[model samples]
Target: MSINLSEPIKIVFNEIEIDDYLPSIKFKIDINIKQFTHLLTYSGEIWIDCKVWDRFSKGLNEGKDTTLNDMDDIFIIEIIKNNEFIEFTWSIKRKDPEGNVMTAGYSSKITDDVYSVIRNEFINYPKWW
Candidate 1:
């Protein structure tokens, strides 16, 4: 892959979640290009890609369901190329050794000069509630 030495790519903080939450839990993420997202271009240069996930637990069947816990969910993010697929995986190892999957991680193309805000999942504490 060849990169255009002439084109100066700059990163732009398009989205932010400094004061945000998932469900009721106080979740946060500092999404950045190069630092996180590592999309390789045809020029052999990496595009910006910083992906995040929801840490929400669901379908309660626990002995203690009084409060939502991050110790219960394993949210994730995934990435893929043109024909390849980016995938995120969810698993619960704390609750159960053979954890259950909640949802496929949300993934997107890594690119510079762009950013996004992802909601971290948390059960019980909803923005609505």
Candidate 2:
């Protein structure tokens, strides 16, 4: 789907906030779109698994983790299209201790071009952002 890959774009992981001990980790991601876009406004949130969260928190407290790159978190993106909010989601999965996969997996409705742009933004971060 021919996205303008050359257009300048920026994606930054701003801050992490935890709401509860059911322990949802709230993150703010900003995508600076300086080029083509059909979206009016964009926002996103991701939830990390408890195990991953423990690891993340431990690393944070220990002041060692550089980035959230090694996480298998669920990512959710929302866009204002046609004056309405449309939600999209993507996730990573892995086998459990019992050799069974566990997750309330998700799906997304965003187009290939949009997904490509978003993925590219993160894939290039920490090195080129």
Candidate 3:
């Protein structure tokens, strides 16, 4: 699949580009779209496993008529040193006339080898921008 971005964000770790949003994809978690945040330069909250939900961004869509929830494209995670240049990708979900997400994507790192749901319910651990 072709990758696209509304804003070409670069992953700048410690003032270096370790990876960009359009880099080698590891794996995409099947997290509900609603739980995502639009974090780009902020740190995230710590999960129960101590893994922190770091940052995120509104992703770029490649194909036309593609909504954020389509989940056909893989969301790229540009792991970097400096949080300011970390690359991320997401879709534009809900919006008002001015075009703003009622909610945004946040970072949540997988603490343990968790492959199942946590607490049997979806959680929205707030991320700071």
For this target, which candidate reaches the highest lDDT against the unseen true structure?
A: 2
- In angstroms, how far off is 93's CA in candidate 3? 3.6
Off by over 4 Å in 2: 1-8, 19-24, 36-41, 50-129
Ranking by lDDT: 2, 3, 1
Which run of 10 residues does model 1 get worst, by summed lDDT?
42-51
Residue-level lDDT tens digits of model 3 in 12-116: 111112123423222222223333354344222111111111212211111111122212222223322232333223332344578654433434333212211
Better of 1 and 2 by TM-score: 2
- Stretches off by above 4 angstroms in model 1 are 1-25, 28-73, 77-100, 115-129
Q: What are the per-residue Cα lDDT tens digits for candidate 1 across 12-63?
A: 2122222233322223222222324663221111112111112122221121
| Candidate maximizing TM-score | 2
Cα lDDT listed for each candidate: 0.24, 0.39, 0.25
Report model 2's TM-score to 2 decimal places.
0.27
User: Candidate 3, TM-score vs. the true structure?
Assistant: 0.19
In Å, residue 126's CA in model 3 sits off its true spot by 31
**TM-scores, each model vs. reference:** 0.20, 0.27, 0.19
For residues 85-104, write the lDDT of model 2, one tens digit per residue.
32343233446678887333
